[model samples]
Target: MKLSSIIFIWGMLLCSSLNLFAQQTDFKNFETRESTLDERWELTSESSQGTFVVVPYKPIYILPGRWSNRPNKLPTSLNPDNVAKIPNDYNNFEARFQLSIKTKITSGLLFGKGDIWLGFTQTANWQVFNEKLSRPFRELNYEPEVIFNYPLPSDASIFGLKPKMVGLALNHQSNGKSLPYSRSWNRVVFHAAFEYRDLSFTIRPWIRFSEKFDTDDNPQIGNYIGVGDATFVYTHKEQVFSLLVRSNMRLNNRFKGYADFTWSYPIKGNLKAILQVTHGYGETLIDYNYKQTTVGLGVSLIEWL
Candidate 1:
């Protein structure tokens, strides 16, 4: 009864059971970016017939995370020197959704050259478990973008980099505040993605659109969130791992680097257990400069989306 032998047997059994369940999967309810991009998106009760749907943004999950942050609350003012203000709760339940208003437009109008999509993802940080203030949602960030994904040729190379897919997006991210706490930015993002076997890498660089305001909101916000982010995705069958890194390059990245790591494993059909770890900053719009480390566990409907 060697320990290694028992573990091996258990692993084998788990794989076999997962495979059996997968073969019996309906797949009609599975939501993933890959499946959606391939025109195999999940169907909702309000879905239109055929590949196109009214709401193109796929529903991600019912619950996203239950997290505990190291530096929980942040200063009410967006000042680096100010200490965190109180009257809040930490270690809360979080929920996220990705939705889109479909324009019914695609690359077909480009003479079948590529695929174009308009989508938006909104992330909300909620203190659901706290009864102190009726469990208020702390922050909400909206990201809307128009993406055009161009399939890259196998032999394509730009600046000694081989890109699997190239896309340009007109992106706008904002917290939708009137003043005092208004944090928003507009960008023209360019992304190049590369894939090697089970590993995927996406390089996203953005140029910020100039604003005509007299003064900037959260002037030093870029030092915490950075101008660009690179994501690494690794998948092994039912298990998925993703890491995202963002650093301010202008200051030689003297700022604390931001990193997010997520590991997801299938739990049931269209559901997977998610363990997410984030460090540095930019967990929420209001707390962009508040650095903290957080670990969370929850369920995810789409791991790679």
Candidate 2:
């Protein structure tokens, strides 16, 4: 059977299971738990690769609330468990993979809490693109990054009237090879986020800043001051939408932006189906663009526990 058919069937099963469970038990009567897994897959298009994101949360114990990096994970859509190959075309015919895992430690605060985080990711690429010919030339490049986010604070004003939250993060990325095709530089990044919740919506707005240093000390583009990025996300039951904008001086005065939408529903049992669309400019790695539209549908192996 085709993969799409399989995913559809599985999602239906999950929805069925959830309905049955909800009917037999009084979810409202039960107390909320501290730890939960809200893992899910958001598919865009068959032509575009898929992303599986796992978001895990721990109850508000040491900290007023919880903190995660997207605290979410994405694998390839085809396998969902494995990293997938990046699609290539005449404008972008290259191979690259990047993954970042973050761990957080926390301390209690008066309004909310504080956390320290660490993460790293890297990607290398080789591509040949030709607009006129069947095959194109080749270029090579790679970058690896590791960074630490020190303790940041939050409060009721930050989380909304409901609770308070504040956060801070530091980030850095460096190119590994000196292939003239790739730009090599080290960057220092800073991030801050404020969150608020209303009866129907949860919103998070974040800002990021970065400074770059050229490893080769190239005068033309080396050691340039960096660009900054800002992002906002709003989530309602079964729906999530977000926007991100970034400016980079290194890319010939290029500006990038992305808008994304995701909707999910349970079909039956412990299965669920999700639909997603991401539009961007500059690069998919940074934002959603129309040059590519990724449509995907996926089923959960099990209910979110």
Candidate 3:
């Protein structure tokens, strides 16, 4: 059987289960507990507040010694004009940092069940140790997105997992560069969040908007960066662990994917030590098709819940 067919069937089954269990679940005697997701998303009445309050969207960290097994010295694209003319003097080790934040734009949509949010994430790779390269910034990616979130019933469950929310987002990601180095894409994304005890899961599937072939940079990016991703976060005391997996979902020889695992432990108040290890493609927009393994140790200001 084809992998796409299997995925379709699985999705249908999941939807049916959600509907069935959601109706059967009892909420009368259920007492809501303190939930990390609720706090992060402001899902409940107690959690929701005025607009314009900033919050963490993704982990914010700086890795001073990020080592990559392979570096993409000369980035290439299907568009001949977009290919690099000469190889860059990139070091195997670089400094990496990410800053992500989100804020609620408005609330009380869909009869007071949905909220709109604006988010931005920026990540950069810096050649701090490459003195010969004049400590240049190798790559920078900017992602801005608008999201609509709808909270589920407090006690709603799909199978054994508690359903938290469902939403949609308009997302745009780009490496702000010109010529052979420019890479950008726009996506319409679907989001679902669930929880099982201290573990939280978020699944996002996206479809890219079409672009003109002549102007499209990284035309085959979908095959490398993937169509969807799943993030699993688990919390234990002061420690947090997360795994993010992305896949194109093709079962044949063209299959491609990415995986990132992160561990964060508290170092001080609101500050944590983080270690991240990633393997596969799309670590950066410039290296979207370049597969490599990288390990980074850093300090984190915020983490996924």
Candidate 4:
């Protein structure tokens, strides 16, 4: 069965398990509520009698190529002044999960909204430049994110403002034992999102800032200043289309750009799936041109509490 179908079954099982636990409770003061836990999300409603969660699995393909810079055809060390070099066949694979969690608060807060997740990401880059090694570069990361949403009254839009939300994320990466120069990196990112919604349309814009630090530099490649990244997400729900453009600026004067297009469709109930293609380009370690492209199919586990 497909990943989505499997997740639905797992969620049902979890709900049933929670119900059994509730019935076995001896204290009358304690109440049993439904809870959900999956690869995508684990959620529980405050007044709910049980839990409901969903897990989504994604199989993705990534193609990172330097069409203008070939590893074998060019000099061992690239010379930026020379423009006649061929491109390289650098490709990679990525498995990604987008997850979330939501629970109603019993006290203090009036509004209810949960967290967002970038989920689990594993990327492997096949280096055409060095074919003799066991591998080129492999990385795995699990980064769960949290988002807080605060809705503003309609009159707030008159001042060119809309509902605002904030998000925070922590990402930790582990470079497998392949390249001798393997090093780990940790990053903390903060985001602020704003949304404008009317009866017929919705527009959302968000900005993110991040800082990365090196953990163990076994090879002793000194660390540099932090980096900054920002993105703009535009969506037209009526047309089932979304556009995402992201740019990262480094203190060392290097920058990366990402452009993506997505088409989405409803799969079952509140769940939706999206197919996307992302094109990226940036500066390599030697300042040579670096390019990457990826095509992926993703499932969005959606809910409104």
| Best of the candidates, TM-score | 3
**For each candidate, C-alpha RMSD in Å?**
10.1, 14.2, 13.6, 11.4
Question: lDDT scores for all predictions?
Answer: 0.60, 0.31, 0.83, 0.36
The 10 consecutive residues of candidate 2 with the worst lDDT sum are: 58-67
Instruction: Find the 10 residues in a row with the least total lDDT in model 4.
Output: 30-39
Candidate 1 local lDDT, 1-305, one digit each (tens)? 45356436644754564445446443444443342222322212132233233343422332345555553454444433233445455544554333233333554434454656666777666555555555556677888878776665656565554557677889888888655456777788998777665566778987777754445556566767888899887877768898999877765537656898888888876667877788887777777777877777766555544
In candidate 4, position 28 carries an lDDT of 26
Return the candidate ranking by lDDT, descending: 3, 1, 4, 2
Prediction 3 global C-alpha lDDT: 0.83
Residues 30-137 of candidate 3 have per-residue lDDT tens digits of 223358788778899887656887766777777777999888899988778789999988889987888787889999999888999999999988876777887788
What are the per-residue Cα lDDT tens digits for candidate 2 across 122-169?
332222123343332222223233322222222225325322223343
Candidate with best lDDT: 3
Q: How far does residue 108 in candidate 2 sit from its true spot (Å)?
A: 7.2
How many pairs collide in each candidate, listed in order?
A: 0, 32, 1, 15
Q: Model 4, range 1-305, lDDT digits (tens) per residue? A: 45456446645654464345335432122112121111112222332323222222222222323222322222112222322355433334323332222332222233543444334444433343334433344223332333332333324454454434344555444434333223344555554444444111222232322323222322111111113333333334422455555454444556455565666665754335667665654212221133555566655433111
- The reply for model 1, stretches above 4 Å from the true place, is 1-65, 76-104, 109-111, 154-162, 212-215, 250-253
Residue 3 in candidate 2 has what lDDT?
38
List ranges where model 3 is wrong by over 4 Å: 1-34
